[model samples]
Target: MRNAVLLPNGFVLTTDNSAGIGEKEADLVHVSDEVVAYFATRVALMEQWAAGAHPISIVLHNFSGNKNWDKYVEGIKKLFGEIAQPCPEITGSTESNMETLQSAIAVTLIGKQKTDSAEKYTWYVYGKPCVGQEVMTESDKIADLKKIWESIKSGLVESVWPVGSTGIAEECKRLGLRCELQGWDIVKSAGPATTVLLGIAKNRIEEAKLHFGKYFEEIN
Candidate 1:
């Protein structure tokens, strides 16, 4: 299912990342607080935009102390800039009372959907599945958020599902697809949604293939 809650007014998309992946003393990955927040926010933003929702606000949950607050906000803004969209209003809290060893953060995006009508489309995968340290080292294989956003706006893509830790096969199952995705490690975790599942309009299949080039692969 989509990682969003449908409210009477709009959808609330939320995602979080934690563990020893930050710059904290206990973090095993040794990445900056900003990088950690960026990928975490990327998951939520992709979920919001994939559902054709316009983001209105953002809520951040910071557990890496007060000093990292501004860095987290900067990361959120950077993601929005990549999509050429203005950063939405952001408000959240930081865990200042206690010193946490690992870096942890969560992001919530409030967005409004533009249409209610549903359309049938073909499914495709964009980018390779990468998790953990691969997220940083094999970053080039990750899907381009900017390109995906533009394709959706241009009517080339009808819907999108960012593959998470559940992997590609499970996500397809969640979508109710019966076919197997050949030539891919369908069970590998796509940490922070390094890969994206695109629902393309039948007529725009070729166009999307051309637009995404080698990153696009048909799900058979």
Candidate 2:
């Protein structure tokens, strides 16, 4: 039996399939900003899970750096100080290897049995007309956002609400969709039979409000 913790950005960390990098100094590595955040968040979440957690294998990924990948794993261990070392692995993809890869990833993260009932949830939000310094235009931003959304959604991740770009919302506003204009925040899952996810940030409350107001309306 094994257990896994998934990050908001749709990455799963586990101990299975730690074979992709050939040989390395450490068992884990960082691949991107999202991944770094995953490691940071995992440290906090694991402490909370310890109260009733069972023995589980773990998998950590994103060690694609050309140098010092092993050092990063040590850093993660030092940072989390709670999670046991996991088997490490690198990710690859081919049309033929898709299912096999996913299976490998799942087994590495959640183990052989728990994945049979993986829980899924969505975290949604909206943002303004502005673009980051590196992100040139709204069109470019839309394409990039869609790519990220597509990858996560392809993995059965759901979007709690329609993602509204400042451009998209402006178009929607013209169409009279009553788009709300406020900052955003997050709402976390509460207990059994619940499946809500939250953002990891200081202003998550305001971030959630940008779309759903104080509470979500019940669908009948």
The 0-to-1 C-alpha lDDT of every candidate, in the order given, reads: 0.84, 0.29
For residues 138-164, write the lDDT of model 1, one tens digit per residue: 989999988998998888888888999
Which candidate number has the best lDDT? 1
TM-score of 2: 0.24
Q: Superposing every Cα of model 2 onto the true structure, what RMSD results?
A: 14.7
Model 2 per-residue lDDT at 139? 27
lDDT, candidate 2, 1-220, per-residue tens: 1124554433434332222222233323313333232333342223222111222333344333323334434534443343333433323222232222111111123322122213433233333233222222332222122222332323332222222122433333433444443442212111110112222123333433443333332111
* Cα misplacement distance, residue 173 of candidate 1 (Å): 0.7
Off by over 4 Å in 2: 1-55, 61-67, 82-108, 111-181, 185-220
User: How much is the lDDT of residue 184 in candidate 1?
Assistant: 83
